[model samples]
Target: MSNLVEFNETSAPGFVLLGFTERAELRLLCFFVFFTIYAVTLAGNLGVVVLIRLDLGLHTPMYFFLSHLSLLDICYSSTIIPQALWSLVVAKPGISFPGCVTQLFSFATCATTECYILAAMAYDRFVAICNPLLYSVLMSQRLCVGLVAGAYLAGVISSTIHTVAIFHLPFCRSKKIDHFFCDGPPLLALSCSDTHLSELVVSALVGFNVLSTTAFIVTSYSRVLAAVFRMRSPPASRKTFSTCASHLVSITLYYGSSLFMYLRPSSRHSLEDDKVVSMLYSVAIPMLNPLIYSLRNADMKRAMRKARGRVLSLATRGSQAPERRGGPLHG
Candidate 1:
């Protein structure tokens, strides 16, 4: 009804997402490709969560933060990938106003939460490497929990503000979103009303979140590098750096794409380029997280192997027990 109404007093009810309109023939191929990506993202991140939970040896602060990161990755990918996959498969890729707002809130919350979580992880590594004597006391269980809670709280607060700002805008005419997902910029572009306030708020929040988190990560790693260099043994230094290499790589990929997409001037906005950059963070990064962490870390591999072995042994015993009960009894 709202969508049918002309530009009068009511806001637009829904948005038509112009997703990947290059080649109609390639839609199905895109669908299956992204479907596989979504599946892998879910499986990989979920595996990390399970590994962290089942392996008691991974109860340290590093793994603790890693489990949280894995959970965030799952949440992060879920906010976008399902809709993206559906858009690829479905003919009419439309999202209601409320649906778009909800997606934006969810995406923003997850993204902001990830930024804070990554910073917390960097701090964890900093303490472990730089201040080994005070590491346990500094990154205590209570403190870690508090840090995690703070991350979620910050995410919620920021997302709520952005959602409110976007929803308050009047959208009477254009209802087409130029991108695949409900991001701040594309949504702002669709609003009939002046978006100066919305743009300002987004810019301020984006700068604060990105700059602060980047600063924390940079400072942490700088100290980590210093500490590693001071170590006497070359192998020990290499090992110390190796522990953080995967995380650093992931951070670079995520933040690099994110910053390039969001922090750029609006004059340079290109929907096509934005979608490509978003894929780096929304899709590819989630799929790569588990691979990077598990493949690079020896402990995770051992835990995974042990877990697999246990599961198989249990399954074998279960089947044999039933067979033995059903078979001829011993004398």
Candidate 2:
């Protein structure tokens, strides 16, 4: 009993996050690269949210869900990137046990919420394409609100489960986490207790989330394609395809990387490999989402132009007002 008490007392209460690499030059390069990505991600995702909100033309089921998605991306990226950037430059990048748990919960919530949001977006497209006449009626405002709420609720529940289950276990082993962020597998590796059930719980939840969302999206898109092919008007079909194309790209980037990261067997889990893959789904995807949606979708392009025009007009008017006031004649 005394030896056990000594062992527990000697273990650190905080965790050391050994970031991507330890070399000084590489750390500098990583810091700059990730800082730039974080800036772009914040600007792009926030722009999407603001644009959707301000532009009345974008007030539809598609953009409604898209706005929520942008918020999620912002949150998702924020949860990981700042800490990672800090960890890169610091001599000792450590996080308290509470902080680690908080990060895990935050990161998990954003990720899971994003999964359902993407699925919801797919369903919105399904209704619009597959049930054109009844699109608005089916995807009513109340229903959309409920869907978003449900996604968040589901995320919170899943995160709580994972956080409680993992942190409750004793982590008496080495305090050095092998990855950048406080992710599940690395944290599990630090535990002195058996983590079989925790592993099972994580795998089950992740599998269910990933597979279910992917299935819904695939099924939705399949029906959409069939409906498009059946359309007699080539232009209409093209337009339908164009609208769905941006969504397809976003879905591919997020789900493809996430599936690669989470759904793999534990035996093949490599910390080094996991960092690169996690960077994709967590960091890169958020930066790409706004660009994907805006650059490809005609509506977003038009909205950008209109918003630009408004800003330019406001600036011009403001300048003219100052000049008019300074001039002698037009009082």
Candidate 3:
């Protein structure tokens, strides 16, 4: 294995990221589409983070996780979208070995981090709903920081392992990756070496991540629902349902698509289908996260309105101040 690594590393193979080459006419269309999605994703996620920070009303554990989730969305899109848009326009779109490794590491890190973060959020929600009284003490600032730190550490560990595993393998002749980005599926497909071990390792790692987080989410939500059902107040029931609904939708979209894409054999993955799914999870989901949270939740809408009003008020005052200074003071 050591000798083989030397040979593969010495060759310094590159990869070509062929992004959505179905129709030449549609390249421009796809470019614009991806551009629009990336733009919206940036605006929405950043807006969420900014709103959470500026608004004291949202200084709870839930909003802390949400702000981090938005930050993760921003990182997620940045990893894949720009290069994808570039691929559409460039004549021979290829990334060097180092560049591909960097891309893989960043993508994996963000994804793995998000998985744990979501789970942490589920636990937060659980405590909030199931044990409203102890929620404050249970989800203290110290514990929140620890959970977030643990998520990041998990991401780093996962990314480091996968990146080393994939790159260590011997990539002989084939350098052209069928889909966009240096995803595990496509990268493994390109490897000339036996990927059985890599696949098993990845499966175990990703499966553990997916299963553990999912199990926690399921357990937490189950308890939450049970607690909500026993509640006598109608408004309380409605509030609890709304809070969980957004998370359920988010988890479903991300986990469902990702499980389908990654938890399968590389041979079973069709290039076209893989590309579409990748775009759906990596590109579309980020743009949707903010909308899912803001549109579904009343508090978010209120914050947005308040934020907008503040901006408008500032603009109004600025305009009046300029007028007053120019008209009376200068004269």
User: Which candidate should be chosen as best, given lDDT against the real structure?
Assistant: 2
Q: How accurate is candidate 1 locally (lDDT)?
A: 0.86
- Tens digits of per-residue lDDT, candidate 1, 186-283, equal 87787788888888888788788988999999999999999999999999998888889988998999899888987888889888898889888888
lDDT of 2 by residue, 1-331 (tens): 1111121323557888888887878988999999999999999999999999999999998999999999999998888998899788675577778899899999999999999999999999999988889998999999999999999999999889978878888987888888889998888888998888988888888889989999999999999999999999999999899999999998998888888877788888888898888889889999999999998899999999999999999999998997888788765
Q: CA shift at 196, candidate 2, in angstroms?
A: 2.1
Hey, what RMSD does candidate 1 come out at?
3.9
* Error at 112, model 3, angstroms: 0.6
* Candidate that beats the other on TM-score, 1 or 2, i.e. the better one: 2
Off by over 4 Å in 1: 1-12, 319-331
| TM-score for each of the candidates | 0.92, 0.94, 0.93
Regions of model 3 farther than 4 Å from truth: 1-12, 323-331
Q: In candidate 3, what residue range of length 10 has the lowest lDDT sum?
A: 1-10
Model 1, residue 43: what's the lDDT?
Answer: 93
Find the 10 residues in a row with the least total lDDT in model 2: 1-10
User: What TM-score quantifies how close candidate 2 is to the native fold?
Assistant: 0.94
Estimate, for each residue in 1-331, the C-alpha lDDT of model 3 and write its tens digit.
1111122323445777777774667877998999999999999999999999999999999999999999999999999999998877764477888999999999999999999999999999999988889999999999999999999999999989988888899887587788878898888888888999998888888888888899999999999999989999989899889988999999999999889888887678787898889988899999999999998888899999999999999999988987877897777
lDDT-better candidate, 1 vs 2: 2
Winner by TM-score: 2
